[model samples]
Target: MLSGNTKFLQGVQIYLLSRDHSNLKSDFRHGNGKIMVNCIENQPAAELVLGKHVFLSVAEYYLRTKTG
Candidate 1:
């Protein structure tokens, strides 16, 4: 387990605070028509997941740093 640090928590807090999900759709709808038989084309969900991954990567860097 990584050591508990206030800076890492602060970073996560900032990341979470920057989100604006008011315009996000709360349902699944496929792109290129539903006839393609593929996963739903959820742009908001995709962006949130991608952003979370990027945040986690940056947080990992801080965790691995000496001064963190």
Candidate 2:
């Protein structure tokens, strides 16, 4: 259980997540190219498009449902 003082670690997306094990290394980068990016939760990746944003944190969405 989390206490009032317990702090949640800032979830950072350092690399693009993938299901393919072979692509795991490639997910980090290709050649000298680096794809370091972090997705902010709730904030729209771009202007609001219909009811959904370009990217949303699946983990946070799941946690909200279970907690609520």
Candidate 3:
């Protein structure tokens, strides 16, 4: 997990990363680059809360995969 100064900003970072990862190719070709850039501009509080839930979901997935 992130710590200290980074912890505060991690959620927004994750949201942007998740949004970009979902919408754009690794190379970021075509129009998705614009959408990715736009989605990251606002940084809403709700998205931060949602991002924390997403982190929990990811941890659960990894734990289940490891156990099974």
| lDDT (0 to 1) per candidate | 0.33, 0.33, 0.42
Query: What range of 10 consecutive residues in model 1 has the weakest lDDT sum?
Result: 28-37
**Candidate closer to the true structure by TM-score (higher is better), 1 or 3:** 1
lDDT for each residue of candidate 3 in 4-68, tens digit (9 for 90 to 100): 54544665466556665544333333532222222434443332222222333476557756876
Candidate 1, 20: how far from true, in Å? Answer: 0.8
lDDT, candidate 2, 1-68, per-residue tens: 11232121122222233334355335433623233333545422322221121123466456656775
Which ranges of candidate 2 are over 4 A from the true structure?
1-9, 13-21, 31-33, 42-68
Q: Please give the RMSD of candidate 1 to the true structure.
A: 14.7
Off by over 4 Å in 3: 1-5, 21-68
Instruction: Tell me each candidate's TM-score.
Output: 0.28, 0.24, 0.23
lDDT of 1 by residue, 33-62 (tens): 111112223211122222222323465456
Q: How far does residue 25 in candidate 1 sit from its true spot (Å)?
A: 9.4
How displaced is residue 10 in candidate 2, in Å? Answer: 3.3
lDDT score, residue 47, model 3?
Answer: 23
The C-alpha stretches of model 1 lying farther than 4 A from their native spots are: 1-3, 23-68
Model 3 Cα displacement at 7 (Å)? 1.2
Better of 1 and 2 by TM-score: 1
